[model samples]
Target: MDRLTAFVSGAVQGVGFRWWTRSQALELGLAGSATNRADGRVEVVAEGPRPALEDLLARLGEQPSARARPGRVDAVVDLWTPARGVQGFRSR
Candidate 1:
């Protein structure tokens, strides 16, 4: 598996972005959480397979947030071993 981090920007806050992300991640069988940064950006850390991760990015790019804008991300995806099994996706 792999872990991916995405820093989503623009219209990403206060529009149910985190809730949407949590749902999407869970649907994609990803493990992690999404949260709003103090600077009004959204942060996501998801762990899943490569293809699925790519798919998630594609989907996110296709569907921009309604409240905040999504900007370029400083993302890193690498081999990830889950220490504790994830129960569900959440917004933090």
Candidate 2:
């Protein structure tokens, strides 16, 4: 398993971004949390197979579509770490 922590910037607050992240993470069978930080960025931490985590990263930067991303996303910066047995995805 891999642990990825991504910091997302732009119009992310109060736009259901965390909820959307939770849904995507759950769909990919990942365990972690999407947290809103005081600096107005959403911090997404996910632990799962590397492939699934990669997919989630891709989803986080998805283009506008039928089900577009929750808000206007300007950038996403992430770091990878060893997984520590996260249990379930949650929107914090």
In model 2, where is the ten-residue run with the lowest total lDDT? 60-69
Best by lDDT: 2
* lDDT tens per residue, model 1, 1-92: 77777777667778776887787887888888888899877877787787787767665666433424344333323333443445567799
lDDT of 1: 0.68
Instruction: State the lDDT of candidate 2 residue by residue for 1-92, as single tens digits.
Output: 89999999989999999999998899899999999999999999999999999999888876662456789788899999999998988888
Question: Alpha carbon lDDT of residue 51, candidate 1?
Answer: 78
How accurate locally is residue 86 in candidate 1, as Cα lDDT from 0 to 100? Answer: 55
Question: Which segments of candidate 2 are over 4 A away from where they belong?
Answer: none
Clashes of each: 8, 0
TM-scores of the candidates in the order shown: 0.73, 0.94
Clashes of 2: 0
Q: Pick the candidate with the highest TM-score.
A: 2
Error of 2 at 35 (Å): 0.2
